[model samples]
Target: MREKAQESVKAVLPVMVIVLILSFLIAPLSPDIMVEFMTGAVLVIIGMAFFSLGAEVSMTPMGERVGGNLVKTKKLWFIIGTGFVLGMMITISEPDLQVLARQVPSVPNMVLILSVALGVGLFLAIALIRILVGFALAPLLILFYLLIFLLAMLAPADFLAVAFDSGGVTTGPMTVPFIMALGVGISAIRNDRHAEDDSFGLVALCSIGPILAVLILSLVYQTEGSFSPEIGRNIATSVEVGQLFFEATPDYMKEIAVSLLPITVFFGLFQMFSLKLEKKTLSKILIGLVYTYIGLVLFLTGANVGFIPAGNALGTVLAALPYSWILIPLGMLIGYFIVKAEPAVYVLMKQVEELTDGAISGKAMQISLSIGVAVSVGLSMIRVLTGISVLWFLIPGYVIALGLTFLVPKIFTAIAFDSGGVASGPMTATFLLPLAQGACIAMGGDVVRDAFGVVAMVAMTPLITIQILGVLYVRRETQSADRSTGVEYQVDISELFAEYEDDEIIEF
Candidate 1:
């Protein structure tokens, strides 16, 4: 417990410091803005920590055990069907989809929500097959991405960013842990050394499904009745922590709980068929469920109360200022720290490092994420400045990244794309969206079209950077090969023995 708490603190500290610096040294915010953001940051911390605890308690064990059980079967349809259902069910429970759905201007929230969920479910099935067939991750990625680029060229320009953004938002705090563990458990049952290599690519592939689905959605959204969102209102009450907690806490808790129920229902179905969970295992998971519940509730309350509004207000103030160029640099600084705050990132980085025994360091992944996010933000600000179609950037960018997939190490290509989705989690939704929204309002631009693509950009860049790192690693390895063999020849044992052999006994 103490160790977990320390981990949570380490994760939260980066965000806390960023927030503090932004509030004081940057555009000084109103007291209300400060209060609201602090509250929101607190909620994010609690949400992440508790959500993590809960996954350990319930989601991981259940997903692993269920996956392991199912994989033992020889029936092919059973594996695909189970994975599909599980993916769809988990994606529905994700709060990030809801958050993005609210931003979308066309179609009912439920329509977009269900659409994205279905897409994830379908692709997860495909990913499982890829793993089972021992397929090359590179060629499939290349082929599918070529199709995506073709679709992008034919599709409406507006659909481009939204499509890519759908992929990232689906892989939020709620969806990541369970889905990853399920992939691992299922892969582990195969008894192949390559299982570890195959344990990944689930995230990378699942991300693409949504982009394609939402591209279809964009067509529907173009014709369907427009859905306008009224920004959520907080009644002007005396701002007290106690009062805010009582009112907003229940609301967000209910929202998160409702979203989470489908996963439990799925779990219940698994339980009905003799899941074979030890009693102690079940008890611990139940405890984790409780912790997750409390943590998410607090997390939502704080973020909504403090962070979202403060973020918006900060953007508003910064954009209105004479030195609005500060937006890019300021966003870069925050982006550098922001990805660190994501609890799931730690899980991903640690797992990769451990699997490869530091051949793939978390430090490298972290640096890549930070640099990618910074660049994405700079580009997003440019989008707001000029009303360019999202395609102008996203289409070519993905083409380059997918093109690199064929050239880089297989794992590097997979992990890089997966990180793209994982990096654009709740903080982007709550804080960065508000930041961009605030700036848009200041710039007199269409907030829906201009400000919204920051998350998309944030998600897109990591695919390129991480893959580039992979290319570097590959080059370095190639260059080192000749020198390594030369060293081997120079150090031959025949020369070493000259000093110590029988003749040497007399000469020495």
Candidate 2:
């Protein structure tokens, strides 16, 4: 617990420092708002610590058990149906998707949610089949992404960013841990060279479902409403700051409860019917569920109530300046650090490291993700300023990302694709999205066309950067092996024996 807290602090503190610097020098926020922001930061840190620990103890185990048992049945239809049903249930409960659905005014909340959920369900079932049958992940990614881009051409122009953004947000904190663990559980049934590689790419494939689903839905529904940023309230006193978080706590408590309920219920049912584990293990999972609930409540409350307003305010202030172009560099800087603060990134990095047996270190993954997100944010800032179409960036970006799949190791490709989704969790939605929206508002740009794709941009760049890391790693390893192969092995035992006196040679 203590170690987790320290890790959480390290992850969050960098961004807090950046925000503080911005607040002091560039974007001067009111004292009251600053108080709110600081309070929220503390909550975020604490929440992340609990959440990380909780996921390890609870969500991961439950997912693994369920997945393993489901596959043990050896019934293809049963596995597919269970996978689809679980996918939809979990997607419907994901907080990030709900947040996104509210932001997207074109489609009704239920309609958008159901569409995204269905996409996830269908793709999840496909992912299960791929694992069981040992299909190559890259071909599926290439095919589906091609389909997505083709549909993008026919979908409404305004819906492009939102459609792509759906892919990122759907595989958020709530969804990543279980889905990743479930992959591991299912892949465990296979005893081939590709099992470990196959354990990944589930999140990657699941992410695509939302984009394709939303794009197809966009063809039917005309985008009607303009985008609106959630405005922050005026805070006058310290008491009000406390009051603000206190008030937001209940709503988040309710939201997190709703978010957690479906999975908990499913797990319970699975335990009774399939798992039937001993009480000791079940008790630990139940406790972990408690921690997950508490952590998510605090996390969402702090992010939505405190971080969103601060991000929006800072963005508005900076973009309103005469030299608003600085927003590009500033956005890049924030983007570099903000991704580290995402809860799911921690899970992904840890899982990748564990799965690879430290061949891919967490530090390396973090650096790659930071670089990816930094570039993505810089590109997004350009979009905000210029009102450019998202397709201009996405089409070429994905082409490069998909092309790299052929070059990098299969495991790296899977991790890279999964990292894309993991990178764009709640932090991106609450802070980065609001920041882009705020900047777009200041620049008189269309928020839907400009700001809505920040999450997608964040999601896309990691695919390239992580693969590049993989390329470098593989090159270094090959070079070392080549050098080792070139060297001749020789050892002289006579030199050591020469020093030994006859007095010590009593064995003769």
* Candidate of highest lDDT: 2
> lDDT for model 2, on a 0 to 1 scale?
0.90
Question: How big is the positional error of residue 434 in model 1, measured in Å on the Cα after superposition?
Answer: 1.4
What TM-score fits each model? 0.90, 0.95
Task: Give the per-residue lDDT of model 1 (tens digit) for 103-158.
Answer: 56566888887888898999899988887777877777777777776776766655
Q: How do the residues 311-335 of candidate 2 rate in per-residue lDDT, one tens digit apiece?
A: 8888898999989999999999999
Task: Write down the lDDT of every candidate, Cα atoms only.
Answer: 0.75, 0.90
Error of 1 at 162 (Å): 2.6
Candidate 1 weakest lDDT stretch, 10 residues:
223-232
